[model samples]
Target: MSDNDNRGDKPQGPDNGGNGGGGSNPWMKSLLIWVGILLALAIFVTMFDGRAATTGGNTIAYSAFLDKVDEGTVKDVNISRDMISGTLSSGEKFKAYPIPDSTLVPKLRDKGVAISAKPEEGPSMLMLLLYQSLPFLLFLGIAFFVLKQMQKNSGSGAMGFGKSRAKMLTQKEGKVTFADVAGIDEAREELEEIVEFLKDPTKFARLGGKIPKGALLVGSPGTGKTLLARAIAGEAGVPFFTISGSDFVEMFVGVGASRVRDMFEQAKKSAPCIVFIDEIDAVGRHRGAGLGNGNDEREQTLNQLLVEMDGFEANEGIIIIAATNRPDVLDPALLRPGRFDRQVVVPRPDIEGRIKILEVHMKKVPLAPDVDARVIARGTPGFSGADLANLVNEAALTGARKGKRLVAMAEFEEAKDKVMMGAERRSMVMTDDEKRMTAYHEAGHAVVAMHEHASDPIHKATIIPRGRALGMVMRLPERDSYSYHRDKMYANLAVSMGGRVAEEVIFGYDKVSSGASGDIQYATGLARDMVTRWGMSDKVGPLEYGEPEGESFLGYSSSRPSRMSNATAQLIDDEIKRIVEGGLDRAKQVLSEHIDQLHTVAGALLEYETLTGDEIKKLIAGEDMDRPVPGAKVSSVPKAGTSIPKTRRPNGPFGSPTPLGA
Candidate 1:
């Protein structure tokens, strides 16, 4: 391999020179140099001043002529021996023994005085300074690098906190334009102007018109309030800022208000943008009204929101959209003409609207060729867009579970049943006797509702367990209605009482189940409303009795001092009892008249476990039941378009019923 290839394969590092500086730490190099220099200086000093002598045995005798006595040696020399003669250093001659060089050599070595014939090498002085300072220099460098990194990260960290948390989607995300939002045709008309303004704001501004400051989307939950806002963004092709009302709140006192300001600031920067706030009721609730602490953090947030919304210098290019299910609880100031200038109500889809919603959701799913969206729509009377979408998805899932490629009609039917009655409880055990009793109870409700309440016909009847009920009988209006008349109320009460009345009539006594508890409560409430609130009681003389007596000493009162006194109160109670008892009696009478048919229907329920309204009618009148009764016109059943004509007839199936006055 070439030198270039070898270099690439080998790991490399920095090189240092060999004054103990070659690949050596500066501090260690310096220490080695200093120790070498000290050793060299000690060797030179030992060479100049040498001491040498030799001895044998314990003593040595030295006889020499008297040499010149050095002044340095004569001053302190004195010798003495036991049993031998010695001389003192006062010019007196005497014999003496001296120590040996062997002992002296060890003494000199202990005092760091060694004698060597050859000299040793020593370290350099410059290497010592580098060795002493290298560790502190390396430590300072490391700390400087770490602090710089920390400062860089802290500066960049601020960018993340200031960025808006809203997720932005372009045209590629999904196609849910204004065309897909159906049912609320009127609402769509109102929002179209917004799309126009967004498309060309200068057009409206040139004519001296300002876009609406804000629009409030008010509706029940699941009614596509949020969907409409998204559609507006998609149609306008503008950046959409979406947030929930709760997002503005935080533990800090002014965090919510600060967030409101920040949100508007962001929106202003992105001019011609839509800012959608879902569930606005969280912070926009009526000011000065809330439970608990009462310091009102939500109110402060709402106040900031109001100021930002209306106090902006130039709001021509920005549009605000807010949604709330509880429009009733919002502050009046927030909804005034200048603020949420347009209030669009997105109500539950009507039948035609539901069909359109079904069409929209059915696009992606593989539905059977024979499936009819209109039929599904008719089956679902009060369904919203979200519910319809869920229905389609659920139906598709049901088909997939059955190992089918496309959703069949049967799958859709099952999904609808699941949505309406709740999931089936095959594990819900019931005794044969209990099942029979449930059948009879449900049959009683269906038969009376079908025969008496021509306006409220039986939709379906079943003895199968669903939700909390062992049996259920569904009654639906003949058509979509916005108002309920007095007769309809009385008919509803009679239907509600049918189950207990049938149990009483057939068994010659009452065997009520807790399942009828809700029914009883509903009936009782209607009776009270008739007497107290509706003034349906003749004794009460067309005066509402349930009106609240405001600002009383003992809080709100349900009753007021009447001119009729105590006896009249007694009469009112009697009238309420009479009205409720009359409903129960009428239900019993209707069930008795068709006693055999009721048993037949109940027996069928025990066999099939469920039956539709049409099926129950077949069981009631046999094959001939499809035709009207002889000499009794079906005219009492109002036609599709006409109003239910007021006529006082008999108190039987054909009677003109009246709601009990509350």
Candidate 2:
């Protein structure tokens, strides 16, 4: 609960690598400069065109010009057929047009005004051409600007296709220090040295220590790998360049490679900065593993990245930090020492880490006194930092929906259910018979699980439809368990079979619905793992039979065919079935022995729709619950589900997946 709160930490650079997050781009400045130059050139041309511009000489009436010529007051005269111009006796310049002008030249000749027969000096050919083409030049400039603007808008403007999309984050944007990060403290400690080195390199240099070149953050999704990198940058007060690995791959050949070079160029200018490539597996895959041709765009991008990291010329003070969930797919060369000098495993947070993470997130919320972070952490086994953050957000949102001043424990419980189990689906209509069957199914699970000493305790049981389940029983582990015990696995299998067992006992074999599809699928998978992988089956000794991932990208080997002979494969299958049937039989036996308790639990579910673990115990003991009776749901009229998937855990393994029977 005392974990330092970084609720305010929202660090918001690269290569002054200033083209960062919201920083100014050099290309944009260049574009503006070109526009200004074109404008200045157009103005210059308009000012200098001799023939198209006025001479700025004074004008006089034609009759006055005649009077001047007659008086011989004009010292000199220059005349064309249409007009006359001369310096008067007083040496002032003047110009006049001839009226009914065939005699204009003759009059000028009579006056002896030194008139030239050549038409008053017309503009040069070069000037005429320039003046004529000015409009077209302006049109082309405008077209060029529009084209550049369109390209810029699409992020592929003139010369923009090859520019790096890496955003630079600076301290001024928002400072996110190590304090902002919670959970995965080991990974934080590993990265802290880098920040120290960046802040004062001489501290390490004096001791003959060279700054580590790179660090690879390997973890599952939502484990806070990217967040840690930003925290390092914030702590060190250095430029942070962030770009997704996918941003490097472009449809156009050479574009990706060009971007890699450009990104490094920007990073070099902002030396001692960190360049973080997120989801690096997108571009940093094994080069030849599944690549169609030797010279594809992604491969080229990867190759260029390799050169930039450790090429002929050294890149000083530039640190490379990359993140990926699938480190197995990354190229080996990229992982060599001096490149990614360290591989920091940012695994899912443990129970203690989760509590700290909860504390950090809770600081932003108005939490009720009853909101114990420890309780929430206990229920959320296998949750990552991102999951805990999301849990807090969901709880706050739930509280706001209820117009509560503070987020309470009830809201956190509901948010957890929504996060792990699918959200409540009360609108999915069910016939009374379906409802009764679901009640019996969930009751069987709760009863059978209660009988298993090794099984995790039931947290909640609901007959109301949720996610894809018509009903479900959720189990909360006493503590976070990394590896499952053999007994626990068996208990899980029995609990999984409980729903089907209950339906068969009450409704008979012919009346059983397909509601057990997800359970059966989960059971079969678990049993197979137990037999083939865990070596739980005595018949099949401990040996990995087949690879879970046999499919690979670009012909790469991510899988191996089962090495066991046909007969051996058949034996493995038999063991799996045997394990499953054993669990099912155990479930049947437990449900039969506790038949009365199962009925009581089911009746309570029908009455209340949902019950906590203690409530179930109380009802079985013939005690009334203190809570109010469940009311009808607001959206209970029945709506066809659009979110519920065929599988119980549709969102997959990122967050706390809907546990078996949950």
Candidate 3:
């Protein structure tokens, strides 16, 4: 840290006055242009006043001059090209315009007034030059200013086009440390080596091992990739240079390449620094995807980045950390072994990670005694670090809106509902028939979930409208699973189709509403994945027919044309349909067998508008109880105390463990 104290004032880029490409500051240059315009205007006004001669004369009309001559009172006269000036008998200097007449001068002579014709006094040579060139000068000045500004804003300005746009955060400024970043402990551990290398390169170099030139962070969005890089900088106590991928490219060609070179040059001077490029896929897409026939600007930029990462000369003391969600689209050259030596994957947080993330985010907010981070985390599956942070903020906001001083578990539940299903549409008015229909639909989903052991546990079932849905049934897993088995997949499909089955069974097939549109779509997709991706179709055998939409290098998908014939394609479709239909039949059977239970649950829903999972379970178990009034709040659902058993898929990751079946 002490070593970096003096380097804090080091030059950054053109924006910070570090000389690289151009000298004139674009903003200052614009100011000078405007100042020139104001000066030109002031000079024009002075010249106009000089011509008026307002201080030297009392103005008189031409007829007055003639009248004075007729009275023989005019003493002297002076005539110019279009004006007449004379001294009257009263000794006042008068100015007037002369009329074109031959008799005028003769009358002046008969009056015995001294008359003389004076040559017009022309403007001086300097003023004359200014008069001729003022418009051109103003135009040139304005044009120059405009061109510079366009270049500046367009990212192709002569002065700054090649200069790096990276903003440096000094040791003191970069206050983020490993302590602030929660979740993804494995990624943090992997990056710890980078911190060690930056702190003392000799420790690794002496052992004949060169430090890695770069590390690429691959993850879904909002997974704390950038935050990890900042933590590395804070841990190593070095300067951090940050920039976005889009900042490198410009409308003008070759500018992006030049910026890459300038950025590396800056990083070299400030050695032992971290250069973080967020969303690197923007500039590092596969080459030869040309716009028309030739190489595009982005390709050239990526080429330069490739060379800079592992050029002929060593890039000692500089570590590049790039984050991208679309690693599949990145060029092979940029991700080669020598270029980006390490690839760290930052996936969504599991249950444990989610709890840690919640703890980190909740440090600043005041919470009630019953606010448990573990319960909230268990309820939030597939949540990234950013999402968890947002959940905490939203819960605080919900409490504030209710005039509460401290956030309670109730607010957390409300916040989770808002984040997952969208805000409640309390203002939406519905008829009694619509309410009853929604209640039945939700009860169908809840009952189906309870009957299917492989399916997740029901968290809540409500007829109240949320987001775009008329009703919602939330299913949350007690613990994390990395993969899904066929049983679970089938159960999930059955649960998704339960609403449509219930509607068809109760209201008749033709009378069923379109509220199950989303459910059908989800169920269909699940069935398709089972056939094409999971190889669960007996006719299709153990072969995958679907071509993923991106490369699978880091578990990302890329698309390819299908090689199967029309007959095989037809078989795949048939298998998908068979799976979906089987699930539908199962859901219908479960609902038909327990029609009485469905009626009871739906009745409770109509009475309360909402029902907790425990309450639904009790009602389905044939328990009789006093129901609350229509507007009374229902008791909070019990927290899940332990994780459920997880089963692994045939050829998938450990398990597909997501909170609440997101």
User: Candidate 1's error at 185, in angstroms?
Assistant: 1.2
Lowest-sum lDDT 10-residue window in model 2? 1-10
- Sort by TM-score, best first: what order? 3, 2, 1
Poorly placed runs, candidate 2 (over 4 Å): 1-138, 147-160, 291-293, 548-562, 621-624, 627-662
Q: Model 3, range 318-426, lDDT digits (tens) per residue? A: 8889999899899998898888899999988888898998998899899999999999988888888888888899999999999999999999999888887778998
The all-Cα superposition gives candidate 2 an RMSD in Å to the true structure of: 10.1
lDDT per residue for candidate 1 within 527-635, as digits (tens), equals 8788877777677768766755333433544464545468767877788777876777667667656766666676677767778778777766765434332221122
Per-residue error (Å), model 3, residue 6:
51
- The alpha-carbon RMSD values of the candidates against the true structure, listed in the order shown, are 20.6, 10.1, 10.2
Leading candidate by TM-score = 3
Specify the poorest-scoring 10-residue window by lDDT in model 1.
1-10
Residues 521-552 of candidate 2: C-alpha lDDT, one tens digit per residue: 88888888887787777888888775655236
Q: What's the TM-score of each model vs. the native?
A: 0.68, 0.75, 0.77
